[model samples]
Target: MLAKPAMAAIWVNQYTGEVMGKYDRPAVFKVASAAHRRLFGKSKAEGAFGAITGKLAIGITTIALLMIIISGLIVWRPSKGHVRNKFKISITKGTYKFLYDFHCVGGAVSALIITVCILTGLNWSFGWYRKLLYSTFGTEVAETTSHKTPAENFPAWDYAYSKLSSEYPDKEIRMYQNEADIVVGGCGNQQATDTYKINPANGEVSSVTTYEDKAESNHIKGWIYSLHVGSWLGWLTKIIYLVCVLIGAVLPITGYYLWIKRLILKKCHSA
Candidate 1:
């Protein structure tokens, strides 16, 4: 369900104003569809795969970009004066230029992915995506049943935090409770309360990053959720994620327009 690669095909076609020959579209869609089936399952594939894949693609691409810039610099150094010299710039300089584009232009064009990631993440913060992911991942996700509230409930967030801390005795707790009916977990070998959430009435300690109590060790989801939501960074972190999401949406739209303009220019020149 990689949307980056999917969008790339669409962009390539649109930029050239030429559809892929029949064989190519089927091949591309086939691979995409298969991946979707594997990751999200047949239900997601048959229904909203396009939208889901498109959104997820943007996020995956955006994350890769941070490293791609560094990798590009390492790989494409032209000062050694190999084939890259035909571009008539030093390897280091050319590599830098290319990386700058890879960072800026590539990020700009793929901002849609970030946008989708943020929005979908926000959506996932709700019960809907949680259920979807749980089912997709084959985790035993229980639906919140309408049970009577016990009059003898402890302070949900505080008690849950204590319980998690006592139970794990290793990982730090963060964001024990938020506006939504969900708990979230976070990073650090040492304890940090900022990355957790606690359910008040039932002592349901759900981590946005983890539905149940994790071990003393951190999981990838725990780390990624911390990084993506900026829970690790404080209020400034949330602000940064918000800003990045807004800017990410801008990048893809602008890139689309830029590509269109270039297409126009190319057509005019040919004419």
Candidate 2:
């Protein structure tokens, strides 16, 4: 993702009706090169490349959606022979059934929430998406990241768990490692929807909490996260998310083969 921006920047600076010598190219590259230097130290090229490729995921996702839409349209439209024949292939019927199912069913199932997630994530990856979702959701969430040094007096996770358990006696603490630099503290009710965050360093409760305090609340969004990640609700949500992801993944593979089977492979077979 960062790599896409860096590469795009490099291309724009180099071409875009601009003229420059090799010396100037290195100088222009230096702008992106500095981000590289910061991330990968002396290995400037790798840093720049990483930034671009990370952001490139959104572009790939967008392209995938476009392909699915086109394939879906082909599946939806009628064949030329249909008008002349009394009985013909329905848009929803055929021998290459999985292909149509892959595009239509898979797409209809995953399109809404996944698209929102992807589009918002693209904004999130770029900083703009956070603002947009936050604004639209009409909630002021603390999206800002914070950090604190581990306490010398206690283990961070143990401290967090003890503190959270004491704070909400009914809640159970679940501490998870979040990347290399951070420890995540989660507290949820034993049989309820409420979740809270705790700061590992000082055992102080953190403000960036996610929970369903009562029935019929913003926890619907919280449930979406649970549904998406398969953590909050139960085995059912997990299985549903896993199956949806699998279906979504298969769409491209099956759709591609379907396209080739109809457009190219079938021709070759007949010939």
Candidate 3:
């Protein structure tokens, strides 16, 4: 069930040139992202069923994973004399033993990585959590004024786009027009780094805010986002994160099997 969405996300990243430094995302990535929206919902905007489902899934899975890890640790307390054996797979003991060791040890090793992924995901899933995160970073969400603009007097898209793009040659600019202001967001190296507010009527730049110029907390927040998606350290960390996610995907299946096997063996012995 999760396989398709995971693969699609990886596919989108592949085309977006995340693995490489290039930003030339192909048309196919749009299709893949659409599929992602259909599966995970449109993440940025609200009111989509997919988005609601995705959030619910994240919350539930995070709790479930935490329980599993804690319970497993409690049940897996090895004697002091053989404590070291818990970390090693004993292939000589047979397939079942090897699998049991692998599942236990592998899960223990990957627990921290998976926990970080889950907590970060939850931060995006819940509003209160998001607020807390922003507060911890010494920033709050930007507030937009509800001022009105006459339709006939609205700013031209091309004019705003061109002006902002020319001003920030090194950054990719995306323009937004609302009743209150003409806002231009500038992204460099794949993350939004700056914002510009332009006067709609005269196309004059009124204010500029650079993310990097903000407090250290803001930088920490940005790093958290990059780390969540495994893009912080480039290809190497991405590969490691990919592996950890794959292990996370398989843990439930392996755990279920182990449980069922234990039940069967106990029944047979009792008989």
Clashes of each: 22, 12, 0
- Which residue segments of model 2 deviate by more than 4 Å? 1-52, 59-95, 116-120, 139-141, 146-148, 155-227, 230-232, 265-271
User: What is the alpha-carbon lDDT of model 1 when measured against the actual structure?
Assistant: 0.45
Model 3 clashing-pair count: 0
Model 1 TM-score is 0.33
10 Cα displacement, candidate 2 (Å): 42
Q: Runs in model 3 with CA error above 4 Å?
A: 1-54, 74-84, 135-192, 198-207, 215-221
Error of 1 at 129 (Å): 15
lDDT of 3 by residue, 208-232 (tens): 6676565655555565667677776
Model 2 Cα lDDT, one tens digit per residue, 1-271: 1222333322122124353322223545755554322322333224432444545554465546756665665555546765333223235676576465556656656555455445533442344554555556665433322232323333555566666566667644444432112112233211233334555465555654333333332433343344335554466545766776677677778767777778886788889
Best by TM-score: 3
Note the Cα lDDT for every prediction shown: 0.45, 0.47, 0.61
Q: Estimate TM-scores for all models.
A: 0.33, 0.48, 0.62
RMSD value for candidate 1: 17.9
Candidate 3, residue 12: how far the Cα is off, in Å:
22
Decreasing lDDT order of the candidates = 3, 2, 1
Better of 1 and 3 by lDDT: 3
